[model samples]
Target: MAEQMGSCKYLFMSLLMLFQVVQCRVLTVSEIVDVKLPHQPKSFRIDLVHRDSLISPLSPGNISSTARWKRVLERSNERLRKFQLDSRSYSDKVSDIKDAQAPVSSGTGEFLMKLAIGTPAVSYSVILDTGSDLTWTQCKPCEDCYSQPTPIFDPSKSSSYSTVPCSSSLCAALPQPGCSKSSCQYYYTYGDSSSTSGILSYETFTLTAQKLPQIAFGCGENNQGTGFSQGGGLIGFGRGPLSFISQIGPSVGNKFSYCLVSTSDPPSKTSPLIIGSAAGLNAKTFGFTPLIKNSVHETFYYLSLEGISVGNKALDIPAGTFELDSGGSGGIIIDSGTTITYLKQSGYDAVKQGLDSAVSLPQADGSSVGFDLCYTSAAAAFPSITFHFKGADYVLAKENYLYHDSTGVVCLAMMPSSDLSIFGNFQQQNFQILYDLDSSTLSFAPAVCDSL
Candidate 1:
């Protein structure tokens, strides 16, 4: 009878363990699908929809998966070329303010925001760019302009629109400020040779049902570029004084955060772009890394990437491989507009070698898919990649680093760069990334962006 009781007890214990394992698995799946937000109120919240989303104004409707992938690669390559040129330009500092040039790009960003301008407010869709510094839109009286979906903004219709005089401090802040009979004139040339010429003006900007008056922006009269034709204009979120964030940073405590939903998820699921204090941040859950400063090029956010690891083994890379030199070269930048992560040639080589050794799957040709490292099997288990920032260790999920093309090709979502390394939006998906200007640090935590 004692032996029978002992056997029954063992059976009961096994059942309890099995029940707990099932319960944990269900909880984990639910957490991934639907993340709960903190109860605290957000200061300013905006919906950031992916450009490919059906609800977005810039959505490319019902294209083949292959065509869509090709387009994505093309845009990423163009943006990467722009960054490479910009790095050289930053190193070659010009003493004279007249010769100062700012590098700009059009229609390469993956996210779009719907914002209103003027006193009565005219709604327009614009590209969101962290790499750019000036907020601009196509204006009326077009000598040369691209065909945008929305009507051009006519400053004459807005009662609150006023051009900035050349003598104003704001006008002088422009890289290459011009004067057309006392009115401040601005000309911006993109890396792709696209250009925009217009008058600097102050107008009321509306975001998320809130009115922000006297925001300085460009009213482009002569804008010639295929990149600008896709959307109404571009909104700059760089660190420069004229950027939208810089102009409003003081009021918003110099803090901003964004959570990008995974591209694999439904495009209809929108991400959250928080402009003030972010919710659900703590020391235990979130990791912090210091933001390295680049006096020459202040617009880009630089970070010190110590090393990288594939699975559990660290890559054999030389020290200071990702360090920023005094001349503003060889640093990693976190960019919201870029789609894929780019690494310096040396670093890229090491990472690729590491991934090749760890992923035990048959190799596949990726040239047609726009990737270098690819595998044939989609169901094969893959190792996670971890980025070792100064004080933070960000471990990426398999979905973050591996791109499963619709044609049954699984490829690594990274590339080699000849210039500066970039931490692009693809690697940043599903993480709440907070840029704290006041603390000179960047904090991030894993999250389900759609729920946020």
Candidate 2:
């Protein structure tokens, strides 16, 4: 009788366990909907196409390599000239549109990005410029506008579009703010005398599948420029309160990253530009350099370039050669708009001397290719170049600093400047670059940009 009771108790316990399992599995519809999962960080990504790419509307199809390199150098020269002239303080405010002579230029940025704006999204191609501040696009009903391949963005069609009043703090953030009645107006002049004047407004910016609302931008009714004819307008990635990155900083955790593909790659291949939480960027793998601050010109991203190396030998560059002075004159900037890197005369000389000593190949004239250093043999092995930044050593692949022109001559892809030095897009190719404004750091790692 005792054994029978024990068996019955065991059966009861087994049935109770099975009932509990069934109860847990049979969740109500509302209860299932309310269940929480592990949190995942969100990121937005877009493609960055080279302007000369076949996929880009700006591409001059079938152009010779010599012609392409010449155009890049010309634009670089214009961009550097603008940077030199743009030394004015951002703190200075302009009371009216007439008083606004702000020095900001497109310099014919090499990369183009496609995004949509407004309530009913209208797609537009725009220059992806890291050196610029305000994101502006040519709008409909133009007073004066440059020729663009696509239809101009019509603010009237955008239901979500709204103009900022002159009294709003958003309007006050403009370097040179103007008042057209109660609406805030803006005027910006490029280095090449290209200009854009329009009302300051807020709209929804759709990048990829993500819709970012309430973004401050310019609706340029009067716009004139040579380089801007290819694309609709520009999207600024500069360090300023009015810049696209700054406007989206809160949502993105003040982080952004990009990987530029080599120009030698097929024009169809595209690089990726990411904002918010960047994936595959582990701190252990990336080398970081602190970003230097310039009080006078706050838009540009400055770096401390301690020195450079050719092969194994470090160039003997004088201290403070790349330093940003109290007056904000000399410094090194990483610019995405410029195709070829530019070093100050002194620094360039040191690098040129180092290359001359390291290279054993027969010397060739690179004047036609817009370079000072050239080698007759394109297939010959060459020494690697490395940029020595503070707390980081960035090694460059042969493709980064050397290019084989259409004439079958390999040339150094760097130039000399009188005042400012720029680390341009060529050197940055095939590298994943992360800009963390929160940490005040810039991190980079070698990557196959196309794969990323």
For model 1, which pairs clash? none
Question: What TM-score, computed on C-alpha atoms, does each candidate reach?
Answer: 0.86, 0.86
Give a tens-digit lDDT track for model 2, residues 1-452.
99999999999999999999998899887776444433423577889899888888988887988888887887787788777767634433222223535433563788899999998998998998889989999888899998888889999899999998999877887777999889999988765457788999999998876787788999999987565676888998999888999887756678888899988898878989988876436445878999888877889999999999998999998888998888887899999999889999999999888887887777898889678999888777678888999999999878899978887888889888887899999999989999989998999998888787
- Using lDDT as the measure, which candidate wins? 2
Backbone N/Cα/C clashes per model: 0, 0
| Model 2 lDDT, residue 431, Cα | 91
What lDDT does the true structure give each of the candidates?
Answer: 0.84, 0.84
Write down the RMSD of all candidates, one decimal each.
Answer: 18.3, 8.9
- Model 2 segments beyond 4 Å from truth? 1-41, 88-104, 279-284
